[model samples]
Target chain A: MTVEAREARQPWILLTPAVSAVLLLLFVPLAFIAVYSFWLRTATGADQVGFYLDNWREALGDAFYRDILLNTLKIAAITTVFCALMGYPAAYFIARSRGNKAILLLLLMLPFWISYIIRTMSWINILGVSGAVNSALMALGVITEPIQMLYNEATVILGLIHFLLPFMVLNVYVSLEGIDETLEDAACSLGATRWQTFLEVTLPLSLPGLAAGGLLCFVLAAGTYITPLVLGGPTDAMFANLVFEAIITQLNWPLGSALSLMLLAVLGALVLLYNRYLGMAQLMKGLG
Target chain B: MGWNLVRVWTLLVYVFMFAPVAVVLLLSFNASQFGSFPMTGFSFRWFVELAENEAILRAFRTSIVLGLLTALISTTLGVLASLALVRYRVPGANMISTILIAPILVPEVVLAVGLLLFLNFLGIPKSFPLLLAGHVIFTLPFVVLVVQARLVGIRRDVEEAALSLGASPVQTFFEITLPLLMPAVLAGGLFAFTISFDDITGTLFWKPGGVETVPTQIFAMLRNSISPEINALGTVMIVMTVGLPLLGAAIARRMAAGRGA
Candidate 1:
């Protein structure tokens, strides 16, 4: 082969294994789901092959599914907001700190390294009826009885915020760290108040990080299954829980695939919108 | 005074972050079977019980084996892909990069359902091999991202100079480029291993019948019952998770400083 041809071929050769793996494992499965979403599930729970729109119609037309989707979005939105409120200040503090930044960053990352399940379980111990919080409250005479804290929508949101706060903080911290310290000093030197300078300079500079972090938090919170399942009551089950029950418990793959696709579609729409505005390349760079 | 407020707020945030972890640590040593408050005196009984629990031990073994396999395979593929992307002006490089990282953007539940459907369609039973494949797909992007970042930071002139010195491309890669990229490769491999080991959402869907990884097993156990042994297990995992990365960072810093000196 010619040198140019060989050089061109070398990249494809090197990329073959990784690219093929992604194709076969990731894309092919997603295609299968798309196809399956249009197929019918028999009364006996077996998949009936061939194109049908009943799954889509059922998922979309039913008020129950609609409410669940809305509820999922609501929970995700609340979680994202809380993450922003909590994480922005923390990230700012970390970025501005003159102390050991590496250690502080490591502390921020410590919770993430542990299993997510374990972290959620810790909440159970803290919030259960006879758990730590209740015992403390009772001991301090703050309440007459243990308030039921576990297995609720509030707890679900709390758990999500807990899980996602690190991502938000890390993203914001990266952007905040990138900002020139001189800009903040200049704003102050120009007689801007602390709040004004923060609002005008620091906040605007870190908006990209805030947007990226919020987007990630929203996507993750909306799609998470384990947190809701472990921490939520019967009324708090999200769309993911519905998909899980349909496929695993009911053995109804067609309906499950339909629900999965719908969830993916909504999330995929948000991602496309995000890409349109901020660019996926830039988002990934911030994340990395 | 304002700075003090910020410091207090940051301290509170740190406390919030560590609160649950502290609870897990404290509960692990409690003598009570139920992980409720009011310490019943510190004891290692739960740790002993955890050691004796066959189901959890077996699941832990499965997770460790799976993590090692995932690290090995994903790291190998990631290093090669990183080299290609970093060194060569590959056609469709942007598209390839996006495709590789797309898995991270997709929700784990969504990916799990898709994988389950695909496997069912193919009449393939869920097993270790299938789980391994799923993990590699989930983790390869991270490996690529890490190794690619390191590769980009490295000066290309070193490799070019080696090539100009009459060394073959293969020799230059091994003798020059590989050494520079080793730390990133190792870090990426460890990251992949940790992710695979801690994964439960995807594993829940694809794990073989009658088999469980540690996280899956923990999830099941927590759902059915609360026990001190689970807390003990959590503590062990926390130690490893926190300890390993800190240790790795320290070693890397030492090596870097030594080379500088």
Candidate 2:
């Protein structure tokens, strides 16, 4: 082969493995999921293979599934808000601090490496009936009986925040770090108060990061079943939980496929919107 | 907010983040059989119990093996792919990279169900290798992102200089670019291992009947007994996952610093 031809062929050779893995594994599986969603689960616990729209109709039209999905979105939205409210000040502190950025960022990212199940279970020790808060409070004569803090929607949201706040903080910190400190100073020097300068300058500038973080937190929380399973009550099962039950417990692959695709569609739309506006690079940065 | 107030808030947030897991580290040694507080006493009974538990040990071994395979496969594929995408002219590079990254954006449960369906369609039953395949797909995006970031930061002149010194293209790449990319690859490899080790959502589905990783083991323990030994197991796995990345991060930093110096 000629040198130019060899050079041109080089990239494709290098690219083949990863691209094929994604195509053969990820994309092909997704096509399978789309196809499976059209099938039916028979009474004998076997998938009835056919071009059927029954699962999609039941998934989309059933009020039970619809309520759970909306509830999932509601929980995710609330978690994103809590993460934003709790994470912004912390991100601001870390981003603006001197000489400790690496340490703070490492600390921020540590929980992400830990097991999600462990992190969700941590709240059990914290807020369980005989948990730390109750034990401490009872010891101090604050109350007699232990409070039932676990297995509820509130704890579910709390666990979601615990899992997601670092993402929020990291995104905002990256954004805040990119804004020149001089810009904030200039606003203050122009007779703006500290509050006014931040409100008018720093806050608006970091909105993109906050939005990116919010999108991420919402998508992740919506798709999670573990938090609800570990920390939520019987009625607090989210959309992912429904999908899990359908596949694992109910032995209904067709319905599970439909429910999962419905979720993918909603989250995929958000991801596409994010990619179009802010791009996936920011998401990568936050993940890193 | 005032600087002091912000600092206080930040301190509180750190407490909030660490307290949950840190409490486990402490409670793992508690003399009591259960409960989180009142400090009955400090003992290693739970750890001792965990040490003797064969199932937990087996699960941990399974996890290490799985993590190693995941790291090896994903890192190799990621390095080659990123080299092409970052250093070479590839058509539709943006779209291609997006597809590589789509696995992360797609929810884990969706991936789990989709892959299960795909495998069932292919008449492939869930097993260790299939589980590993799912993990590679899940962890591939991390390796790609990490290596691609480092690759973009690398200057092209070094390879050119090597080429100018009469080295073959492949030889120059092996000698120059690959070595420069090693730190990120090492970090990315560990990240892949840690993520694979820590994953439960997808693993729960992709796991064959009766096969268990540490996360799946913990999920079962949670559903069944809520053993205090779980805290010990949790502590060990937490250290394994968090320590790997921290070590990798430190290595990457030192390598970068060494290069700059």
Candidate 3:
């Protein structure tokens, strides 16, 4: 075969396995879930062959599901704000530093590689009744009791923030790293105060990164299961946790699938917003 | 502007970030049976205790095997797919790329349920290979994206020169292209391995009876409370995960600077 022919064939040959896997595992299954969401769970444990909007109707209309949705958004928004607040200064410091930036960046990113479950559990060891935080407080006589720490909304948020902060820092860092240092210098030379220049130039340009990071933090926090499962109170459940309960404990696959589809719908809408406003390149860059 | 102010702020951030993980690590080494604070005398008992825990050991073996297999398969597929996307102007390239990356964007719970339903419908047994397949699907996009970034930096003329010199395509790729892509391939492999190693949702859904990975095992144990053995494991993982990647990123950064200079 000619070289061009061989080269042309190679790409398809290499792409076959991945294309098939993704189609089968990711796309096909999601399509099935979309279909399942329309079906009804029967008196027995199986999904019934009926087309209805009950799942969607319940998800939108029921107060329980509505509360879960609102809680998901609340936790995600809080996590995003905290992450950005903490992450920006850290990313800025690392970006501005000379020799220490790489080290600082590494430290921020290290927790990402460890298991999310482990990291969430680490908080348990630190914040549980007999855990470290209360121990320290008691040692210092700061509180009379081992304050309730784990299995609370505060602890759930703490775990989500801990897990997500690296992502926020890294996204902002990537954007900051890409900005030309000369622009900041030029702003300074043009009689702009450091704060004024930052407000006018740096913040707007970095807004894409901020939005991307916030979206990511929100998606992850909203969709998370292990954190809430491990550290959250019974009432602190997110929508994803409800999906888990429906599947595993309740044995209601159709309802679980319906709830998951609702989560996906909201997630898809938000992702669309990010892609439109923030740009896909920026979103992907932030993810990396 | 004050140096001390900067120092205090940075110190607080560092402490906030590292303190919990650090506490877990410290408590793991304590001689006390309970995984708690107020240091008892140091001992290696948990490490030994971890070794003796058959469930933990079984899960560890499963995780390592899964991670290694997933890394190799995903990295190979990723390298090839990345080469395709980068070198060829195929139709539907954008769509192909988007679909490939869609897994990363999809919620894990959704994917897990979808995969379970699909596998059940297909009558495929949820076995080790099935779990491996799940992991590969999850990790492949990451490998492709990272490897593609590195591949874009490679000059095509180098490959063209080899082709013009009567080198076979395979020869050119092996001698020139593959070697140049090594850093990225390794990086992608590391990424895949880490994701596979840490995965819980997909594994939990797909894993067969009597086969549990580390995260799944820890998750079951965590229903009671966080164990000291997990803390020791986490400490070891923290060192390797952070240490190795940082070393690689630093090396890459230095190389880029050196070239620029």
Model 3, B104-220: lDDT tens per residue? 888888888888776776887678878888899999889988999989999999999999999988899999898778778888998998899899877777888878898898888
The worst-scoring run of ten residues by lDDT in candidate 2 chain A lies at A279-288
Native contact recovery (fnat) for each candidate is 0.74, 0.85, 0.63
For each candidate in the order shown, give its overall lDDT on alpha carbons: 0.88, 0.89, 0.83
TM-score of chain A, predicted model 2, versus the true chain A, to 2 decimals: 0.96
| Candidate 2, A81-108: lDDT as tens digits | 9899899999999998986798888888
Residue A57 of model 2 has an lDDT of 93
Model 2 alpha-carbon drift over 4 Å, by segment: B253-261
TM-score, each model? 0.97, 0.97, 0.93
> What is the per-residue lDDT of model 1 for residues B1-261, given as tens digits with 9 covering 90 to 100?
666777888888888888988998999999876777778898999999899999989998999999999999999989889889998998788899999898888888888888878976788768888798889999999999888987899889998999899999889989988877877888888889999998988898888888999999989898776788888999999987778777876776777677669
lDDT value, candidate 2, whole model:
0.89
Say which prediction, candidate 1 or candidate 3, comes out ahead on TM-score. Answer: 1
Q: Which pairs clash in the backbone of model 1?
A: none
- B122-192: candidate 2 lDDT, tens digit per residue: 88878897899899999999999988888889999989999999999879878998888889789789889
DockQ of each: 0.78, 0.82, 0.62
Listing candidates in order, what is each one's chain A TM-score? 0.96, 0.96, 0.94
TM-score of chain B of each: 0.94, 0.94, 0.89
Model 2 CA lDDT for position A5? 93
